[model samples]
Target: MDRFELFHLGWDDLWASQLAESSHAGRLGRISRVERGECDVLIEMGRVRAQSDSQRAQSAVAPVTGDWVTVTENDDGESMIEMVLERRTELVRRDPGERETQQPLSANVDVVFLVHGFDRPFRAGKLERFLVLAWNAGATPVVVLTKSDLARSEQRNELPAVVAAVAPGVEVVVSSIESREGLDRIEELLTPHRTGTMLGESGAGKSSLVNALLNTEVQETQEVRRSDAKGRHTTITRDLLVLPGSGILIDTPGIRAVGLWDAQDALENVFSDILDTAADCKFRDCAHDAEPACAVRDAVEDDRIDFRRLERFRAMAAELHESEQRVIERDRSSRSGRSHNGGKRRR
Candidate 1:
């Protein structure tokens, strides 16, 4: 198979000049998995483990799964990455407690599966948060509702409406690994070579869903404890898994908290409906609080919008702004510390 075929590179026009140039030069491949600091790259030459260039490290450009890169072969049967082709999409989040550093989750992802557990119902705010990250990544977001079999019949009835309210123009699949339901729908989304990552809280059945897709127990699965409905963090790190018959899947360590970073645009996109309503408010810069003729407030009072959902949106927007400020301060401190150390050395 051609390298593109192996990497699931459909839509040839979307591949940028740098990626095409590397491919034409016969040095391009897709990163399947990143382990420790080494990468497992898939090329026309086949899968090989390669180290990233030390020069790239100086720029904070680390390779993650789905990154198309150039690799060089060494005499010792080892390979080293020479360059990272520009990515079409990048999944990132604010590093917890550190705002300035953007933690890259994956790169060049075509789709993001935001998994939620039925047992937990749905947190509208959390769903919106994930959607913002997905939108920012430039990948289409699909909601995967897991543990459907475990949900009470009434809760099941409420699932669709909840999803529709938060994720407009997005697809939602109700799945149950215990019964193998919705597996085919999920499989259809997996085209060979295209990459996707699973995002959700621990015990949301992310690993279980991946295992179901692969049709094997490739990942270790554990039950959520009864006391907290939280699963033990079985998957300690992010790793890419090649499905037996379909596309590549990047399974991430169960995330307990998903901090936001510079997601203002994303938040606007996710809540565009609310924004649209607010646009016609009496005040151009209205905070939507006690403002006369506020469309958003009107909607809330008329039951046209869920007040709780609106509150969630406002809270997330504020949180993201605060996180960005924190990141800025942290970066400033880091630079100051470095300068101080340099002065001491000179003295």
Candidate 2:
């Protein structure tokens, strides 16, 4: 590939300068796939295998697919990834149960498509979690309601408004992957130089939509089971792919649960109307429940805002608050354990 082709893979001067300033002398490459100790990276020359140096580092900073890294040739003429450049945006989620750590799914993405299927269960509360994930990643979130062809006419008409009501400023696309509805509009969003990824539960037709966008079966897809309307893990790993004539797209594995991780501010952004309405509350720190003059409660009573939306907002806010507390406690415990270990060493 030539220098011009590098731009299509999301490389620019900012990345070039970082690689130049680094002590390691090598080519700049974008990681396409990551294994236990090796990864496939795309460089100006071509895709090549490189070893990750993250394990030798003092901290856990392993590279994942979509990361732009500095790769250098070792004495044996093997490629080694030296460092990972700064990411503009990363799609991260809270690791399951009582863990304060986050699992980064994709890096340096411009937009995130939160795919939902009309044929499967549509939970607004679950949608709120995905919205927070997108907002926290610093990427524009677009709600893609897939499987429109299978949806009843009345169901198709009602779902978008309901999704929009919850998503606030986010765009909601109604599509049928089989019939190719809304494919053109989706393609427009995935313009050249922009990177996007899909986050959805199994059976949401994420891979099928990607195939429709690419106009080929680039990713394998399976049908949702008739009994539960659930889909198998079609896309096993989070692999980034270049769209036929557009930007890059990353298809991820199915997500079963969503745990909030330091998304307090994003919650306010997703539920901006509630925050705006709450500003008129009599108390500065109104909880909106049983308060004498809570504007949020008043709005709910007046039917200005749906009560369930407010309730969902409160639930997420509480979840984030608890997550914050847990992180603090975990850090304190780590420090205490370290201090104790140091004292023992001194003896």
Candidate 3:
């Protein structure tokens, strides 16, 4: 029945409604970092380490950074996470090296920063995957071109064009941690009580950007290899940190493999123009490869859609299809196994 400090941690009326209707009784808090079996939760009393095993009773899903949860004490006098509130948005991807598994990177993210370093090559395929991942999470995608200070004249101009091609109607900003250029554009989008996250490969500038915005050494920065420009993973785990008068920012570790997870609708949104042209193909199921009257291929040939753009679109679509097939196969096999075991699943 007492008041709680929820404004600084991205709480709003919607969350309050959920809290009022929640079946648990404890102090409301937001998860800052998740560890082995416990997590650091920021509560009305401040940050406290709480046992998270209590979460499994109410929700089957494990806790992640940026989750709003309730804390209570058990008979042993240890802080415990009672329950986790429903999430608004989640940045998800197919688990690395797993066919039909999903890895939730961050929860309740309002904005997703597609951070890429201008110092390295802008791999269109990799960046497009990031776009699809962000879009599928229903977050506002912003292309943040970091390390602009090291980029040459041509590199600076060329990178934005590629971003525009892959992500239409999305905002793009060129930024540098040293010069502090274009940081304001990214800051204006971080309104109070909102949540955003920075996602990119390790060698990219995600950690450096987080340190700059937070004005502290919240995350460590490492140098990339001179030969390959591959950076080490400085951020081992994801954590939700608060900004001064701004919203919360989730800094995640470098993601190497970005496979899709239920992103078919998002793929269409990203490449609607190309799919629209495919409507005129000779066959309804036309693959657009050497097919007669293929409007999609014609669009590429006539310079309507960039060649690489079309290629990335097709590649992502294929990946989604393969993911669907794997899910089906896994489910069928699971059903068969259960049937053989007399309707009981095996260990």
Give each prediction's root-mean-square deviation over alpha carbons: 3.6, 2.1, 3.0
* Tens-digit lDDT track of model 2 for 1-93: 422277888887877786677676667788888877798888878888999864457674678888988788787888888888878788777
Candidate 3 ranges with C-alpha deviation above 4 Å: 1-4, 343-347
lDDT agreement with native, every candidate: 0.80, 0.85, 0.85
- Give the alpha carbon lDDT tens digit for every residue of 64-127 in model 3: 8988898888888889888889889988889886768998877898999989988777787787
Q: Residue 2 in model 1: shift from native, Å?
A: 15
Identify the runs in model 1 with alpha carbons over 4 angstroms from their true place. Answer: 1-5, 8-17, 22-26, 74-77, 324-347
Cα TM-score of candidate 3: 0.93
Q: Rank the candidates by lDDT, best first.
A: 3, 2, 1
Candidate with better lDDT, 1 vs 3: 3
Model 2, 19: alpha-carbon shift in Å?
3.4
